[model samples]
Target: MNERQRARRPGGRSARVGAEVHQAVTDLISERGYGNFTVGEVAARAGVADSSIYRRWGSLANLLTDVALTRLNARSPMPDTGSLAGDLRTYAANVAREITGPDGLAVVRLAVALSSMGQQGVQARDDLLAERTRQLQSMLDRARERGEHAPDAFAVLDHIMAPMYIRVLLGIGPLTPEYVDGLVDRLL
Candidate 1:
């Protein structure tokens, strides 16, 4: 195979390179907001040639979109505790813990900021929200199948997640277990 073909091969090194690039993207965004960095900086941080990133991600916005998608995909799988209340509580607790962490909060903040820019941001935001919505809906659907009188998935999801996002974005009160319990109770 030619050098270009070898370079494009996916394997351990490619996976490592992708992970490093993603980590660098998150760290850079955390250190210096989303709008202030360049692909060259990310390339340097990832210890890869700038052309590698360009070849892989195409552009800065595309790279950021991939970062957002990767962040969302890395979250723990949705819980299944046999009961809607139990599931909601578990999900809320997990989300609360994540949103309060430095890396998680940085990803969330950057995704939100990027959503306002243009097409790439909008696509990333949509993909992220869609995945989240799908997970919540799946949990609610399982509850419905198990004879629980669940409300509309989207409405229930809004009630549960909106407050969490508010806290994450606005620096509101802590996401205590009591708070999650209250939200779950109110939803159910």
Candidate 2:
């Protein structure tokens, strides 16, 4: 294989350290709330030196932003299941799984916290929303191209995404298969 054909990974030691730092930030946010933890605490929890985080992420807020973005956006590519219903069902279910994962609540909380954290925080929040919207739009656009009925992305966000996220965030209900399916069915 030629050089350009080789897969380049920034993982190895750097990725491990980054994951550790992200997890440390998530745990600190989960346990002590957003503004309550210091860089030293995170470094200790992540088993890396404080200077490591500072050098990599620059500050607590930057690290927190990275954690929130990485956790919240971690997912497989959106499903292209040949129909709107199939895609919606798959997408909604994936979201349900994510927001209900072990660190789901903490990640959600971190995202919410970041939204109120000032200019940089607001920008991070915007970037996340735009990316999610873009993903949803691609699915919807495919359905439309296939000559099927499809609602605008906002409708999906309002009717489906909002409820599941709210339920998870508020700890009000399980995002069971039935609940997730019902949301998709209602959208269809």
What's the CA error at residue 172 for candidate 1, in Å? 2.7
lDDT by residue (tens digit), candidate 2, 1-188: 53322312375877788788878877777788887888899999999999877777656767787676665566735799999999999888888887788766664666677777778667766766687689889989999999999999999989998898889878887788998999889888
**C-alpha lDDT score of every prediction, in listed order:** 0.79, 0.79
The residue pairs found clashing in candidate 1 are none
lDDT of 1 by residue, 1-188 (tens): 86556655787887889889999998898789887898999999999999999887767877887787666656756899999888888887887888777665665566667776688767766766687678778888999899998867677658877788778788987888998889879878
TM-score against truth, every candidate:
0.80, 0.73
Q: Which stretches of candidate 1 lie over 4 Å from their true place?
A: 1-11
Give the Cα RMSD of candidate 1. 3.5
Q: What is candidate 1's TM-score against the reference?
A: 0.80
